[model samples]
Target: MATTDPLGIAEARSQLGTLVARAVHGHQPTTIRRSTTERAVLISEDDYEELLRARRELEAGHVAEAIAAHDRGERETVTYDDRAALYADLGLPTPGERS
Candidate 1:
């Protein structure tokens, strides 16, 4: 089946092996669409690890930039008295936010 076609969660359940094969061997990620707005992709572990590594690198770059900006007096410092205050400042309670 074409990966371009959406796979409903129920159908994905029965054909998991095929989906895994497509991802692991073909490097083709399959989207298991659950709803109009929600879905998950089945990708190879290698792909997932690469994505994670890329994200870490990006985050580190951002942090370095933030530090450089701070050193240049281009950033302001604010003190928060509590977790709620800090979270509020950062627009906390983000979707699916974890502790």
Candidate 2:
């Protein structure tokens, strides 16, 4: 079974190779901790990219909802002269641009 518990920094450092192998090959994430509140997770590159992609999709959905609300006059309208500038303001890709 995969362990989700956080490992102490020193122990994690000592077993970095095994930790990385578990994350990559076993598709498991390992949390390393310096303290109770200070921690970081290690995952495969594919998992990291998947997380980024999911976040982008979520942000895009939120932006689309806000735009729809503005169009329906449920929210204050903010006009943009340029589409690129509009997406840039939201830190997203333009309508026709590749994501």
Candidate 3:
């Protein structure tokens, strides 16, 4: 579905019935705006839950834990050659090679 333009609180409230109807049928989401500036959003219950779950995963430090696990056996040193190799691989002149 196409993206709907942002809506203010009053516009949303006035058309609340239609919005609910559209949402029930899985129509496109409506972006809620306020004071000519964007604010929170109104979305289907399922979508809201998914958003919350994603936020919780980020806040609970799950990402950091995963990174720590992945780097368990990796080396900690970073060298000048590493930077030079990366630059060469990307077809970019290395720091000292620049004219």
Candidate 4:
């Protein structure tokens, strides 16, 4: 989901007050760029905090669902006698082994 066009650093710097007002009062987020690279975003404090809270809630819900699934025996369990063989099968490094 892309927002409005990004503002260059120079333009943003010159219009900091206006940009802040737009983000806060107009509920519009502005992307700030350095040269051609996107650097940061300007959004209301309330909106930022709300986004953070929503992310945490979503993560917590995922964790709870995983726990419930485990409790219900909905997950598969694999036990490998040779840990190195298991890692090789999965194309991953065994414990204490460097990639």
Query: What is the lDDT of every predicted structure here?
Result: 0.77, 0.84, 0.63, 0.75
* Candidate 4 residue-wise lDDT, 1-99, digit = tens: 225678888899999999899889987888888867547889999998998787667656765775687689985555778978766745555656644
- Which residues of candidate 3, in runs, are more than 4 Å off? 1-3, 58-99
* lDDT of predicted model 4: 0.75
With a 3 Å backbone cut-off (N, CA, C), the pairs that clash in candidate 4 are none
Error of 4 at 89 (Å): 18
Ranking by TM-score: 2, 1, 4, 3
Off by over 4 Å in 4: 1-3, 76-99
| Leading candidate by lDDT | 2
Consecutive 10-residue window with the lowest summed lDDT within model 4 = 90-99
Candidate 1 has what TM-score?
A: 0.74
When 2 and 3 are scored with TM-score, the better candidate is: 2
Deviation from native of the Cα of residue 90 in model 3, angstroms: 30
lDDT of 3: 0.63
Model 3 superposed RMSD (Cα): 12.4
* C-alpha lDDT (0 to 100) for residue 6 of candidate 1: 79
Q: List the lowest-lDDT window of 10 residues for candidate 1.
A: 90-99
Q: Please give the lDDT score for candidate 1.
A: 0.77
Query: How many angstroms is residue 58 displaced in model 1 relative to the true structure, after the best TM-score fit?
Result: 1.0
